[model samples]
Target: MLTSAWLDGLSLGDPIAADPLEGGYASRTFRVRTALGGSVVVKTQDNLPENLYALEADGLDALRAPGGFAVPEVLRVTPSYIVLSDLGTSEPSPTYREDAGRALALQHQQTADKFGYHVDNYLGTLPQRNPWTGDGHTFFAEHRLLRYLEEPNCHNQLPADDRRRLERIAGNLVNLVPVQPPSLLHGDLWHGNLLPAPNGGPAMIDPAVHYGWPEADLATLLIYGRLSDTFFDAYEEVHPPSPGWRARLPLLHLRELLCITAHWPDRAETVQEIHTILEQFD
Candidate 1:
């Protein structure tokens, strides 16, 4: 029976079980079951920003809006810990995956006045800058991509030729990518962050949320790809992307790769992935 004040606030009595939700190296996640009734999820981070869980709770609320998916409910948010309603461990059914894709497209329909968020937040451990901007291309190019260049690792690690190519890509963004309204985005919408809910359809977790071109979400969806074609088919039918989005994925993915390298320069797999994408620019 953990007796932290926040847990006491829940008044759910002692948890029957509280298992670590292990996977990523960044945060400690737990699945807590109460003897009286239902379960909840808890996550914590060390040396965290005071608003970290608060920001996450905000993003969860934002994503839970009428999208074709579910987000675990926010039970409570403390400086170090966030308690969420348990969503269970079920993998999405094929139909649920399709629904998830449709829901995501619908979610993207929700737009913003500019290309950023009201506040800065985190992507894993790396800081994300989200100052609002009117230009989508500049927003993606500068805040999403180029900003990582200033990081301690990213600055010197990215090669000069590739850096120039990034400059070229940024300069030619208007020509290369679609100009569109800033759609609400789950800024990091890869497979790892998505899950199936017990009650019904799919739900997403661990968002790096912002308001930006929806293609940014598409670009991220396939990064460590495992989603079926049905997912994309459903997504495109609901919200067809810019004509050459496939060609643009490698370009869009540069942001994440750079972010990963910026945060953990020693991750060889990520470093290799960065090189692979940069070769296209070279």
Candidate 2:
């Protein structure tokens, strides 16, 4: 429970109210209102990796760095908690989706020399390793795809034959995926992370940011069936996708499916989805 005293300790001021927010599977989130009439979103986790919030703050900074998307302002951060200026969410309009698409494409235009981040970051509670590498294929295969196989949950969920198939697919990334510069990705740009800002533009939250193949972000949005053609059309107006990009959705989506399996070993459906992708590429 949050109290005014706690807010005082953080020097945020006396909170007149704290309202719980939904869709927080990994942490407790609240929209806190202070006596000063300022509202901020507070996210807290009792047990987390030592630097999770700090890393998250870094990611938010990276996203904001590109000046492409509207991300929350990181007002304060501690090991267990983070306070961000509330961007405020609403039901998204078609115009908002289009704006989001354009913003994302423009964001990806800011590329890096290599395919990775300066340091590793998290995808949800899971660690995402990002060792800087020149070859995109090697980076995606080793870091994004195969590395999760070492997770204990994956070992339990995937059979030996399925594991071998995944290896073959990873080995063939060079032949499958088109070469693209290391574009900055929101890294986790699904519908849930995209919000309609009060000013009627797209605001993003909960990023797993890195420099990677831009298709990975598009695939994440398409796989969830939340984004519409308006978004893609607007995106293409800014930055056109590579040829055969649509055909690569299943392949790019393997990263998210594998992560899901690692997070929830009991989710047989996610495992089956992995098998489907492997059968297509392996």
Candidate 3:
């Protein structure tokens, strides 16, 4: 249970109730009601070795900077907790694809000189293997995918044909260099992670913030399922993907699939989805 002292420090009045919010595999999220007749979302994680909630607060602030998108306003942050302005239980806009694509393009315009975040954060619940020393492409290929695939659980889960196909795709992906300028990325922009704001615009959460190929985010969006035709249409209107992005889509998705497989080996359905994606390249 959260103590009143913590609420006092957050400037929130006496609490009414603290109820759990569904979703998210990592932090424990709660919708807190205060005596001031207001509400906010508070996320807590007891097991994270690193200050992940603080990192998320920083990333959200960065994305909400002057020209950034309409991200959720972070109210407060502590080593053990993060409080954010709640958008309530409003359903995320089905137009998420359109709004999100445009919003992300706006975010990419806010760039820095380097190709990575100032501090590293987790991807979902797993420690993201970011390139602290090498270039983005080399780091993703050598350190991220190779190491993940070499794990016994990940390797054994792939059927023989699917495994060969993934190997080939990985080999081909390593050779193809990305020439595009690196842009700020949400890093994890799937449909589940994007929610609609009260103003009808899209709001993003659960970012695996980074600086890398902007197309990588778009590719991940396409991998799970199209965000909606409206989304693709809007995105293309702002910042169209370079030629051959469709072909590269599968390659990019392979990285995410491997990450999920490594983290949740027991999810048979997820494994099958990974196999289904590889089959598309045949």
Candidate 4:
């Protein structure tokens, strides 16, 4: 097999088989199978930031710390390439969804003194700032929602009124948002990012991780589609959400929808979705 330049640099001692795998916006991915019966994923980027894979590696380590949930094991990393244990992708059963909920709730127990992450990370190609803050509303307003408003794509996509309303929403967040201490979060958890585990449970990939409200994770689940009721039932049984969480789902969802609008130009529906949410708050 003709090895790609990245595979040559990896220097894995074992001979391997490689197959192309699609689905990353910023990198080329491949699934490699070894003669020794091991499978790993390798991603290569021509202009990736030096810490991209390293940050992902750190997030995987944190998610794996709680056990039960599966996060790919890091094998090799560099600015150009990252090799990780290949998590299987299969349609999950109802039991799998329930376990995913249970495991995520257990992971959420791993908390921090404040909201935010110790290190700054990227959500796709966009920078996600995570300075520690004593309050969740301030963190969400400053980092999650308003930060994207300044982006060039954001200005181009959202009209002046939509931008102003988002600002108004941010300014009044203290009253609209409920207070909650920080919990570990898979900052991006839309359905496409979810992978079924080899053990028949859930394993997540491409985490934009932080210590934030656990409900933010739940909100992400709802935006694209919902998991089985068993998932929420199991999660609540382990770590119940605040009393009025369902009402706040749109507010939490506004962050990701705005991010999608800011990052991708042709996604008019996503831009309209952000407009709908911001107008709802008005």
The better-scoring model by lDDT among 1 and 2 is 2
Residue 129: error of model 4 in Å? 0.3
TM-score of 3: 0.84
Cα deviation at 263, candidate 4, in Å, is: 1.4
Q: On residues 94-158, what C-alpha lDDT tens digit does candidate 4 reach at each position?
A: 58878888888888888999999989998887888999998888899999999998888888989
Ranking by lDDT: 2, 4, 1, 3
Against the unseen true structure, what C-alpha lDDT does each candidate score? 0.81, 0.87, 0.72, 0.82
Q: After superposition, how far is residue 145 of candidate 2 from its true place, in Å?
A: 0.7
Candidate 2 lDDT over 92-202, as tens digits, reads 665887889899999999899999999998987899999999999999999999999999899999989999999998999999999998999999888889887777788
Candidate with top TM-score is: 2
Q: Which consecutive 10 residues in model 2 have the weakest lDDT in total?
A: 3-12
Per-residue lDDT tens digits of candidate 1, residues 22-115?
Answer: 6654668878878777778888877988887888888888887754568888888889888888888776675987887898899998999998
lDDT of candidate 1 at residue 71, scale 0 to 100: 87
Model 4 accuracy (lDDT, Cα): 0.82
The C-alpha TM-scores of every prediction are 0.93, 0.95, 0.84, 0.92
Question: Relative to the unseen true structure, what is the Cα RMSD of model 3?
Answer: 3.0
* Alpha-carbon RMSD to native, per candidate: 1.9, 1.7, 3.0, 2.2
Which residue pairs show backbone clashes in model 2? none
- Count clashing residue pairs per candidate: 1, 0, 2, 0
Candidate 3 yields a Cα-based lDDT of 0.72
